[model samples]
Target: ERLALQALDRADRLGVAGYVLGIARELTGDFAGSMRCYEAALKLLPNHGAVAGDLGRLAFRMDMPEIAAKFFMHYLQARPGDLEGVNNLACALRDLNRCEDAIEVLRPAINEHPAQPLLWNTLGTIMCSLGDGVTAVTFFDETLRLAPEFGKAYHNRAYAKIDLGDVEGALTDCELAISVAESAEDLATMKFGRATILLALGRVAEGWKEYEGRFSADLLEAPRFTIEGERWSPGMDLASKSLMICAEQGLGDEVMFANMLPDVIEALGPQGKLSIAVERRLVPLFQRSFPQITVTPHRTVSYEGRVYRGAPEIEDWSAIDLWTPMGTLLETFRPTVASFPNRLNFLVADPARVEHWRRELENAPTGPKVGLLWKSLKLNGERARQFSPFMLWRPVFETPGVTFVNLQYGDCSEEIALAREEFGVDIWQPPGIDLKQDLDDVAALCCAMDLIVGFSNATTNLGGACGAPIWMLTGASSWTRLGAQTYPWYPQTRCFITSDYNDWDPTMQKVGVALKARFPMA
Candidate 1:
């Protein structure tokens, strides 16, 4: 502690007060403290180009991209020839969701600093984020030309190649990235990327093994559970010991993995206690679904040995096994489509709410009830592949005898208005339906619809769970492995896939044809 204070004093004397403070606060996980320190430093010496650039970086980390853009622009103005500052500004603009502005900002910088590897890498990342993989690949290639050993450039370029349907190119880059990775985390990232690409390419056997790399950290940290005299298998003599199955991921993962519980229990037989750790939101659902097993929320779980002080504690169990609901598990046990579960009677809204919806539908006599899902809850690398609100079901709206109902959340007002003006149809939006308050509202709404059509998202899941006939649209990469017409999880769902990357027109046309065939008037 004394040595740390001496270093802080030295930093203050060296005119690195803000930088030192930011580092200190960040180490303690106080992001707000780091932001304030960085902001103060910038205010003190506004013309310090390096400090301004650092401030921009800190602002971006705080999720204040607009503020970060200002700082970056100031940094660029101070040091007009600074390629790094220019690239940082472009990234800030991109984070602010001004992709065109970001692209325009980088053009002059690229012209001036043509051979700067970092600048080219930044440009590639921005273009990739904006859904222009073709241009991104070009920029990544330029980056590789200047810095051949840059593993990150290779990894990102592989992603762009995958987006553009260049699978072989992506695989080659992945292999190169894996070879250069120094840390376990870096190795895991490259392995995961390669595994994802392999999964996309329908090479499941190799992909599944690489995918197991995800458990490294957890396996290292947690104590392994072993029974004294029992051997674990599908069916073994396990009359005395308990088997713990811990949930290792998200809510959707929990739902997906819950399907595997019956098999786990059947394997363990009636004597062994199958204990599971799951998220709080899933407690009721899991309890209702699997009454036989012992389900504990993660918050309630405890640890022992070198007990980390202030950490929540729970009982130390005899035998623990971690399970994630990855696609590989489904592929292994239920390889055939026939093994898929059909018990999809979701608990929708009350009868009164259904009656209210029925009355509203009855008021509109001429058109078939159509459900619209313009958004999904999950946001990450895969989100770009999910359908945007502006893109889906345009052809379906163009078809006659179809009435579109809005089931989307988050920034959908603009899309709703545009849809109203373009289609000249009053898009039905229900009032006061909070997702948290009414978890099954979408399923309830699907209960009233003649046919449900949307992107492969939560709404699609809801429709499928409600046993509604659904026309689900997916990206080419996703549909290649999952299949073109059917999903094992959702029995009522039929998939329509894009033939090319970022091209939804053909898929939309297929959906239109299916709609017409299924509903003659539509």
Candidate 2:
């Protein structure tokens, strides 16, 4: 930084100085500072500059795919033949759910630069995004054949292999990818990939160790978390320690990982104090469930293009002895499938809220009240590939002696109407409670249901956490199963998995048959 500033002062090149500073700030996780520097550079060199490409990638890191696409397009116009710009623009389009358009953009680039392994690898990623694992694997093979040293291609092929139910093969590729990975990004990605494969294959101890790689990847931009001086390791003693467990990742993951919370508290012992920082929406439920510990809401703030997470609720950070990400507890408490306790659930829902929902369901048609969740709210091209289409749930709805309750969040009117009009299934929507926002009440509602069946979304995890009987509809490659047929975290939950997401008819039919067998027509 000193030398760059000295050079700028000597040459009077403000744009160059700003660009250099932006790169430095971004590398150090100062995203807002980086954006300010980049914007200054943009003002100085608005016509055409490398700053445009930097802004495009910065936009992507911040989760603004639309802005990312625009910046990448501008960069493409500035440098038409640049493979970096072409590949990034296509990736932005892919994230924007414009898969076909992304393909069109890639087609021309691939035709012109037939020898470019980067282009081939990007095409493979797009294919994986589209759920064509076989086609993706073929493209990855071509990429590796062109450049055997491309670690990204190896890591990408692992994704395709996992989708094709060759988890062991996927793990092998991930190991190979890590061996030849030269860049930090490629190495971190391969480690994370290996973690997913290991967890899916039921190698829990190794998976938890590899899962730490997430902090090295995109989460490097997040605020640093500490209790007193450092993070708690796998086998750290908690007898006289004060530990803060901050939830990481998505809401569903927080709920799922909370399966280890009870064990963590037990390990802390009477002399030890434990504090937890969780998603704000889960504060009430978590506090109620773990009354022995302090449950505070985690702070998540967004600036220019970065998300920052912190436990600002802690009044005395220095007083705390140790801290760890919530998932890290699994590394200590649960190293194998057998390590998981045979408990029904860890989280306890509001008993009054549970009874209230139960009485409300009693007023419905006299049969078993079954909660049905068919999709996640964030169903984009990439995420939608993981869930079954609502239309395929026709068979499950067709089963008699079950009053289907609407547990599917988001704007799912189309699905509810389709079930009623086409499948003759009238899904009763519980009044007054916001399925997405009222998470505490949602947990109670889940507890009230005779059975809750859905893909592994936040609601399903909540249901499973509270010991509600959950039949999760997932693929054979679901890593959350931890190489077990059932969710060891929630012993009450049953997994109904299919090998193919392309055709969910057979799986839906199986669920329907199971539904009938469980609740035959009265």
Report the number of the highest-lDDT candidate.
Answer: 2
Residue-level lDDT tens digits of model 2 in 1-522 = 666567667865578887898898888877778877787788888866478889889888777788888888888888886889989988888887788999999998899989999999989888877877889999999999999988889998988888788899999898989999987766777788799899999999999998888777454454445334588888678886788889988899999899888888888888889999999999999999999999998988776445567888788888788888888788888899999888888999999999999999888887899998888877665676778777888889888778989997898788888888988988899999999999999999999999998998999999999999999888778898888888887898878888766667888899989999999883
lDDT against the true structure, per candidate, is: 0.63, 0.85
Q: Estimate each model's TM-score.
A: 0.77, 0.92
* lDDT (Cα, tens digit) per residue for candidate 1, span 1-522: 234446556764333566567667655645566666666666766677777787787677555678889988888889985777778888777766677788898898778778888888888887777667788899999998999987878888988887676777888998898888766656767877887677666565566555555545422122232212232333234343466554544444445445556656675576666766665555555565577877766543223211111102235544444332223354444444455567554323345555677677776645788777755655433354446436455776777777777766555777777877886667777666764335445456667777777775545555565467777776655622332245555666777766454566777877777777777875
- Colliding residue pairs in candidate 1: 302-313, 302-314
Q: What stretches of model 1 exceed 4 Å from their correct place?
A: 1-4, 7-48, 55-74, 182-186, 214-251, 275-283, 294-367, 377-382, 388-392, 479-485
**Model 1 Cα displacement at 419 (Å)?**
1.6
Model 1 poorest ten-residue lDDT run: 304-313
- Cα deviation in Å at residue 324, candidate 1? 7.0
In candidate 2, which residue ranges exceed 4 Å CA deviation? 1-17, 27-29, 217-223, 302-307, 317-319, 378-381
